[model samples]
Target: MAYVIDGDKCDAKITWLPVSGSLKTGELVELIQLVEEDDKLSREALALKDIFNDIIEEGLTYPQLGYHDESRFKSYYLSHAAFALRLANSGKVIGGFYIKPNFPGRCSHICNAGFIVDMAWRGKGAGRFMAEQYKLLAPELGYRASMFNLVFVSNQGSIHLWESLGFKKIGVVPQAGNLKGIGYQDALQFYFSFVKE
Candidate 1:
């Protein structure tokens, strides 16, 4: 995948190898910022609110799973996720994503991913650019298939994009999402096989 890197802003390129402590700190901050902004998108509002309340805010308050700690961030990428960052033309973080093996043992061939574009940069094609980049990186990351576990049904824009990229809705979980005024709604599962030719 071709990445537009801001040399002054991002000091590192996309690499699976872990970074030094200070650089890792930079990455986490950027990733969190992306997720925070993503929380406001119509498609992500509900799920992000739930996560913010149940995990980020609540768990941190109770010291459950060290939610407030940075080590948890490091450990997540090291153990379960292959995280990446995309810097803006100005060198600030514009987007980031994590692609991971969906399951253990026999199911390890499937990959799952989560991505977000900076709220300030949304609708400018950042999300699309990041996704296109991920498609090229998937095989190198060792994934033969890619799946999105919980796409909000209302996120038709994203649905169209993913469909254009060859993903298909394989199933839906009814009333699985709590949309503010709408109460609850179904969530769609999308999948794509990326087996290299």
Candidate 2:
């Protein structure tokens, strides 16, 4: 399926949700689209960049090595339809993701996405919440399926999250990730179809 509308056109409003199993009541988070026109070094963008770079430094999840400057981060994450999650009251960016066609032309019906949650905010359901939003927003962007090419085997939380969301492990890439301190590790490829076939 071709894009119903450009990814940047898909938008969502600020939403407040209670932290699952927490006594702190509800927290407000605003999901905002990231566009090329946004300042590359804006406060929100910089916060997201820090989180992303932290993940990259962990060397177990994403493939990129070293650090990403503002320009590089924006080029990679904001080049397509991207979104950022922030505390509505504090305006602190806590998480974000990017969606883009997995392949060219006819195969573009399938999209690939990358996600990151602030280390401080993990386990509070932000990742899962963003994932659930992705399930809804991706189809609206005209994608029929979502595919993750390299979910590291050691990343059990991510693997479990994807599976819990109804994504299937379609294949494994042997030694797909050359991680720091861990040497080579296998990677799982996950797929989820939005259309019933």
Give the best candidate by TM-score: 2
In model 2, the clashing pairs are none
Q: Give the TM-score of candidate 2.
A: 0.85
On lDDT, the candidate that comes out on top is 2
Tens-digit lDDT string for candidate 2 (105-127): 67878999999999888877778
- Residue 50, model 2: Cα distance from true site in angstroms: 1.3
For each predicted model, how many residue pairs clash, with residues at least 3 apart or on different chains? 1, 0
Taking the tens digit of each residue's C-alpha lDDT, what string does model 1 give over 75-120? 3422333333344223454445666666655676677776654555
